[model samples]
Target chain A: MRSVRYTPPLWRQWNLVWNFAQRDLKSKFKGSALGWAWSLIVPLATLGIYTVVFSFIFRAEPPDLGNGRDGVFVLFLFAGLTAWTFLASSINGGISGLIGTGALLKKIYFPPYAPVLGAVVAVGVQSLIELGLFLSVLLVLGNVGWSWLLVPVWAAVFTTFTVSLAVIFAVLNVTMRDLAHLVTIALQLLFYATPIIYPLTLVPEHWHSVPLRVLIEWTPFSQFIQVFRGLTYGLDAGSWMSWLTMVAWAALALGIAALVVRRRGGDLGEEL
Target chain B: MSEPAIRVEDLSKVFRLHTERRSSLKEIVVRGRSRRAGSFQALEGVSFEVPRGTTVGLIGHNGSGKSTLLKILAGVYRPTSGGVVVDGRVSALLELGAGFHGELTGRENIYLNGSILGMSRREIESSIQEIIAFAGIGEFIDSPVKVYSSGMYVRLGFAIAVTLDPEILIVDEIIAVGDEEFQRKCFDHLFRLRNQGTTIVLVTHSMGLAAELCDTAVWLDHGHVRAIGPAPEVISEYLGAVNENEALSNDEPGMIRAGLDAVRSGSGEVQVRAVEALDQLGRPLPVVLTNEPLTLRVHFDVKVPVRDVTIGIGFIHENGTGIGGSNTREHGVPIQLEPGVGYIDYTTDRLDLMPANWRMSTAVRSHGHVYDMLEKAFPLPVRSSGGSTEGGAVRIHGRWGAAVQEDSPSTAPSAATP
Candidate 1:
């Protein structure tokens, strides 16, 4: 089939994404009494447990570390968790969407990425709702402003990055079923490696030096959280260099994913 | 536009089957050492066009390229080399509920399935009430579809497709999804869609349905175009092929005699051929069924071993599921002497079944094994007409039961338990 002369309009694609997200949200809490309210209650309960453990049981005190950055500890946790959850939830479904829907692939063909795109958007929409609750907590304590813009910017970068990663996983998962298991391990490692519980400054000075700091700060994953942190504290996200890095990553990874899917999409249905 | 709805020129598909498939890691390691695998040519140089607002039937054997052609048109599989240009929007109900997400609720899935089939949300929103109403699954519409009975789910899905009303609709098979009533509803809905100027492409196993519904038919065999045009003509040829195959494998000596019992072949019923008994050594024996060693010894003159002679048999329970049988050529035994003369034999060493309608048939196989049949014996009735009938077909060897009271009320002179 020849690619149509008209480039695929975003609105049509976005509509598909919307329908999938609607189902994703409704399907998640479909049978329950509260339904989607579980999204709010589960996280709130997790926060209660964390507050009791760190603030009460341990009798820990907020560090007299720095300025506004030091006070936004809960925000840091939520910010990191928000981006991390998006990645985590997405990898689970996105990588396996094609594998899971082998029945449809054998019969009806659409863009191969349709399932992954829908699933990512579905999980992303759910995470945004969770993000809103965390943002409300921040508002109750103080004020939230420019950080919101950073959230969107980071979201754009993170989505592109995660989507690319998801595409690669999708393509690879069909041939190498091991990719799904490997992605799970990778998500686990990223959890502790990133500064979710503590500030980026909490790492000792020697540990954060030169290349080590550069590695952490320059990572696409780091940008996912860094931009959000920068927004919350009303700080700048480095210079044009970070934007250049993000754009380059999104372009390269996406290009690679498209190439893999296109070259191999023909035989994929048979294997699936 | 009055253009034909579907068009094809030299449409063909070739599928490659590797001798052995290797994992990605194995491929990387053995790179240049691996050899090319065997391939299969499923379809080649086949082409047909259905005029706008027409229904076309596709009939073929199980492995026929009918499905392959449909999939390419559905855009699921691209042809290895060839082209298919459809002039209007195409919707494939290749399988009922083919695209439904199990986790999604009935209401949410309606919107999803509707859009996937090309309905705008606004269109779906307007039809949503009608669709739910037609589906007849009241409050359960809000429940996840995972819990829906297959019949209910397919009904809802078919409702969405019919309501969408695309310019072209392709259905792989008729409504095998639901009960008879539901299937009739699907047919009625499809008939309505057909009248509304929507071109339909149908692939089905039922000749009656195809002949009644489709204006034209395309007969495919291992990807080759066997016949094209008029549904009745194409279906007739398809059935002819099926009858030929059945003839090659089904025959028996004196089998004609089996078709004629006094009860069935009475009066105007066809004449019964030689009936006798036999052994494994082509010798004679007697009394069959439930551990009696028995056989048939052929005897008689075939006024003519008519060009279309089919001798077949079947063991059936009252509820009707056929047990096995074999024939003359099937047993690798020959029919004797020539057209006007015949004497041969066969046997049933252990007739493992009990009493039931055991039907032995004789017919003229009209054609090869690709179609429904012509039965000369008219499904012969084999059950004992009277007292000899005692047990079920399974031969359970167990006693029957009855719950009768020993009240002796008459002896007590009209008694009521008060």
Candidate 2:
């Protein structure tokens, strides 16, 4: 068998990513006190914190029309957490992924982007677990919708978007150690600036608000929530614009990340 | 007749060294940002080809580009200005345990390291048992590698590598590590590999080892090919060069000349009337193993000197470092002086040595210093091996301690009378 490191065809990039992804997923619980359960626990704790902050401190109540179901609000929050956490963790760790596996980079003659790909894949697995938790909550709360059928599409788009973004960060992290913090904080600001927890309808409508509204919709997290809300709450995507923007962002991120990895891959060892 | 298994042409690699360290802000400013684009030239125009089943040993001093050349051939590092064509599957044990994850279980790491060495996942799975058995890690294979000692580390790495069965194998200095038993096992594996018609490239500093194992050898000096030929011939030239370089600093010119003349005439049963170290100008003096253009001059009035009396200097090492001396008698230098005053000067090009104390011995006889025994001196401090021999080549004049290890010593004091 011929050993490879993307020297053959570009299609092997996916295989390289998958191989490294397995390594990353294996490392997550490889040495933990609770093993794989840690993935489920952190999100459970985070959900509890948000519930206390939003439900008790603010005493925030969802809009009701003589109905005793606040499941919509809960699903909204859960969906946001799922999308945000996956992208944030993957993107944040992706930058330093090479630095973390510095020894491997110098010793092994494989694709340099493997570590970062592995990290994102690990986060993808975590997101799936989180989705399981989210589903159970939806089932218990008794506010379910037929729109859940579209959830997989939304998740796929967002997951792919997150992975592409992570690839870019992993390459950048090789040269800039601080980029890990920079990307995480940038992603955090994105979460607040988007409509993850907030409803878009709450904003005052204005024609001159076109650019602002478009920018908000273009965010992958927002795009995910938009379609997710559409599926769960009987909300329909008003235009095809959100889908185009999400796809365009993913393509662009992937393109640039691939180029960077291809050109300066050999430098990863030196940087590490 | 067939195409060589591995070929390299004009291979050269230049590393841009970044030696300055600045972890803290204060230190960064104190050291100032600096980078020197110094080229190490780990391999320069090093052209060679190895037919199938040929074992070629690379002998060189440290930093002579042996490792770099091996890395490039292993495909771990891309050559800076040349190309290589390898015709078969390659497994390079550049470093053992390089790809193992300490946090992973030893069994898991076996698969991981194997894949890194170009073993497929299926291949690794199939070979896992053999790897464990060969490593002798036993049930500890289930334990995380963080708990492993260095011996275990080498065992696992080597075990995984040996299972790969690559058609072409490139070995760095890995055989120098581990216990002697493990080293012997490695040799057995290499021997089997060669018998199976696998081509191997070995980089080592031991000339004797190369001569024994390699079909041919190459001498690398600072990234350039100094010589390449038969294993024994090339290795002897390298050893001679290494000694001459070391001898240059601590020896004199005249004594080396006289010794050379004495050896040239050939000798038998020669006795020294006078022995002196010489300056670079061939003047007699009292130092041994000095710098370039120097020698050891032995002036002797023979009582019963015969035909072809051999006189030569033999430097003795107590622990892997050379002490200085030369006599025609020991080195097969043939000469005969019938009850006449005569002198022999042994000449050398240079003295490549580090600082250390050692023993020097000189002897003289007939027929290349092998026929009859004569005078020999205690070794004095001549040069250091500079720790380059640390886990490396065996020093000729070195001493070795030995003991018959007891399996279980009888305990008398702790035993109470029955």
Per lDDT, the best of the predicted structures is: 2
Q: Model 2: runs farther than 4 Å from truth?
A: A1-27, A30-32, A59-71, A139-150, A202-213, A232-239, B17-40, B251-418
* Candidate 2 CAPRI assessment class: incorrect
Q: What fraction of the reference interface contacts is present in each model, in order? A: 0.38, 0.18
lDDT by residue for model 2 over B63-151, one digit each (tens)? 89888777677766777787788888777777788877777788878766765566667777787888899899888899989899999
lDDT of model 2, residue A81: 76
lDDT of each: 0.66, 0.67
Summarize candidate 1's per-residue lDDT along A1-272 as a digit string, tens digits: 23111124556766666676665667678669998788778766766676666556764444321235455445556666777778878878777666766777776565667677877888887788988777676676565565366567667877888887787788778876767887788888877667655556655545545555556666777765666655654344545776777778887888887888778766665667
The number of residue pairs in model 1 that clash at the backbone is 24
Position B247, candidate 2: lDDT? 62
Model 2: per-residue lDDT, tens digit, A42-145?
Answer: 88788778777876686555443112444355556676777778888888767666677787766656666667777787778888888777777666666466
> Model 1: runs farther than 4 Å from truth?
A1-8, A41-69, A143-147, A202-210, A265-268, B18-36, B251-418
Give a tens-digit lDDT track for model 1, residues B56-135.
98899899988888877777777777778887777777876777888887888898877666667788899999999988
Identify the leading candidate in terms of DockQ.
1
